[model samples]
Target: MTTDARALVPLPRSGPATAAGTRFRLHRAGIQNVWQYDEQEFAFGDGRLLLRGKNGAGKSKALEMLLPYLLDGDSRALDATGTGRTTLAWLMLDGFEQTNRLGYLWVEFRGTTDGGDHRHLTLGAAIRASRSTQKALPTFFVTPLRVGEDLHLVEGGKPLPVDRLKEIVGSDNITDRAVMHRSRVAPELFGITDATRYRNLTQLLHRLRRPTVGDRIEHGGLASLLSETLPGLDEDVVEKVARNLHDLDAVRDELGRLERTDTALRTFLTSYRGYLSGVLRTSAQAVSRELEVLAQRRRAAGDAAQRTSELRTQEEESEARLETLREEEEAARTDLAALHDSHAYRSLHELSEHRSTVEAVHTAAGAAFTALSNAHGAEEGAAERLADGVEHLGSRLAELGTEHRELLTQAEMAGLPTGHLGEAVALPRTVRSQTVETQLTAPDGETHTVQQRSVVRVDTATVQDGLGSWQLRPGHALPDGPTLASALRPAPQPGCGVTAEQVERLLTTIALAPAAETAAHDAVYHDGSWRLGILSGRHHKADA
Candidate 1:
């Protein structure tokens, strides 16, 4: 680029605070008017000096101005622009525990002309809440200090115009990289390498309040990254949170197991109900057949009416016998009651409450016998239920095992992954099997195989259409397949008792297949079976 063109680029205005190629000399630097820490001054020669003070001694604020004067030749020094008071532009010309140390800057300025020599300008800035600004916001002011030809403050240079100075500093904002780096460079230049550590060391450290949930998340984001490099991070609280998450997962797993068991039970009940219905129907049929045979043979059997009459007579005699037995039982009970009411019974009761004792014994015996009988009945029911359940479970389980074995064999043949779905494949019943395999060639020309197994869960989705419907279609059946494939195969229409047009019409009626149909190839015949490869080498595209 031409010199004129280079010069045409707008040059950033320079200020004494950050003037390039300048060295500043401070004969003495200190805060003039302030507390016991203030009204202190120290004189140092040209190069550099270290200033130290105890807490509340006001050394840091002095350092802020002095460093700028030494490095860039700018100090945020208060000067008497008016009577009795100085025009203070800095928001904070004070130092404290948490104050940012890198807010001070100094710059050196050099003249391009030969024999122009160099000059130093120092710039220091601080935030001040200005009521004159909108919303009472804090406005930053850069105070530029310049030492001139007479070795005294130059005109219009002491409290330099902040607006023009900020343009050279890039920004007066404390958060800006230029300002922050300048501030940091000053402290490091003065051997304050670890400013934060220095501050902590100077004070008694105390534990802060516990972190809130949001604070913890933020801490995890930043501090967790350091954990791999740092030790002693996984403390007791961290382990406890991990343990709680683990327990929650265990409970979720238990609940899943229960749901699976419940599903299995329902499945078993469905099959059992079907089996019982079949058995009852068979038994009813057999009973009906025997009755029919007896009816046919009944005419040859003599004295049918006599047999009927005899049966009625036997029924009456049995009724009479039952009535007599009942009368005897009632009479026995009455006699026992009378015996209890008699003097002898009263005498026995007086002896040792014998009648009451015998009654208690009898009641105890009856209760024991009744309890045993109820327990036996409950046990019998439970045994029958358990037996039915086990038998059903075993048969289904065996069937599933066999099916699983078959599927595993098929999956092996297909080179599919095993153990993708556990236990179900080896369960009592398997409706269908579908698996996909992929072969990959390495850069070295070595081939590797990867298999994908899709378990066909036996339910509505698996049984919606026959698995045979999912078989690969012939190449000739598709529009583009015949032209591309080496071998051509034709597909037979499905035997659904309906023409393709009729099915198409039905699909259109239901808004499935649109009325406007295009001839698109869906398959290509390659092996003995038609290859249902939907993609073609050139023109074929996949369904979305």
Candidate 2:
């Protein structure tokens, strides 16, 4: 059972060895610029190569030529050094005037692996003004190379035609024809694969020309270049940290936006709350005023209701009195009607008619008396005229008597008979009355005789008969029979068998009834619900 401890332990293991890390070293760079330089060559020696030149002598330009080789023909690296591809192209073409001129940059480099094997490689790039673009944009081309076992098939020290360079590389051999692919080509030729290492080498060359002076090396400085170029650093870890930093920056931006939104929302809510408070205060004040007014209205309504009740009672009482008055009026009218039908009333009415007839007769008799007086004055005037005529006739008779005496005397002398002449000459001396006859036309169109008699005479029997028909007394009260009958005559009785005072009072009450009823109606319309207690007083409050 004794086992060898050395045999039990796992033997020191060894696997197939991996190819070592790669590095690129610049040897020489050639530039041909139509404007700044005709054709120039720069050589770099091992360890601390120093260049001395005047300010415009192409010192920077010579150093910048290494960029295309180190960065695998990335013209943007040249742009970082202030020599843009297009500017460099235009300068090569003699300040943009000779745009057709072609410029060339060729870099020769040595790549050494960790196993100590080394290879010689050349990176070639061409620049020319683009014919197709408005700014004469520079066009770049990487001159493809064909590496044999020991030499480069691509031409050196001269500009190669871009088409020939494409044919040499074969379309699939280069990733982009216009851009240099030294990184890809170097792996096949010298076994170099790390592109970041190549970029660091180029950056180191850039920093050598413009070394940073600060305590911490700035970006793209020698320290940063060395850190990136060291094989010990993990590329994947660096990339992951960079990604995490980017995500952190995005999170910070999102947080800032959220903070700003919160501030804005707070401000808006503050303003809105203030506005709402003001609105609510105004509404409260309005409601309070409305409530006060409603309270006053409620009190007034209560008073009105009380007054309405009182008025209703008065109206009912007045209505009752009116009904009673109406009944009394009907009874009085019935009594008055009965009184009118009584015999005493009839007798009184007849007496009144008789009195009216007597008065009419008296008025007619007075008119006839006036007419008779006028006729009597006319008769007196006629009598005076007749008397005057009779006096004259007597005087004539005296003169006739004297004439008869003389005739008797003459007859005695002549024996004539005088007695017969005296008798024949005798005349009467008395006034005689004459009758005047007048014919009057009556309203009936008949003519009647009116005799003007010396005396107007009345028929005693007709006068006696008229006197017997009516009793007449002067300076005495009307006969008791007519008086008693007039006293017994029917008169309209007072309404309701009530006095004029009671009727007047009833009329006054009726006049006041309408005003009371109107008040009651107004109360019913305005305060009906409240008076009947159907709704609370609060319900009467108006909206603000």
Q: Tell me, by TM-score, which candidate is best.
A: 2
Worst 10 residues of 2 by lDDT: 535-544
Estimate the TM-score for candidate 2: 0.30
lDDT of each: 0.39, 0.50
lDDT of 2: 0.50
Off by over 4 Å in 2: 1-24, 33-35, 47-49, 68-70, 79-86, 94-96, 111-118, 131-158, 167-544
lDDT of 1 by residue, 356-378 (tens): 87778777756654554454455
Estimate the TM-score of every prediction.
0.17, 0.30
Per-residue lDDT for 1-544 in model 2, tens only? 1112222122222454343346555555555543455555555553123556446555555556545333455545554344455344444543354426555566666656667886555665556554344232333333323223332323565455556655665555434443346555546544556666655655555544442434336544546556655556589998998998879978999999999999999999999999999999999999999999999999999999999999999999999999999999999999889889999889999999999998787676556545544544554454444344334433443454454454445434333333433221233322223567767554334675656443222232332232232222344323243343344234425332433343333334334433533443343233323322312221231110
Top candidate (lDDT): 2
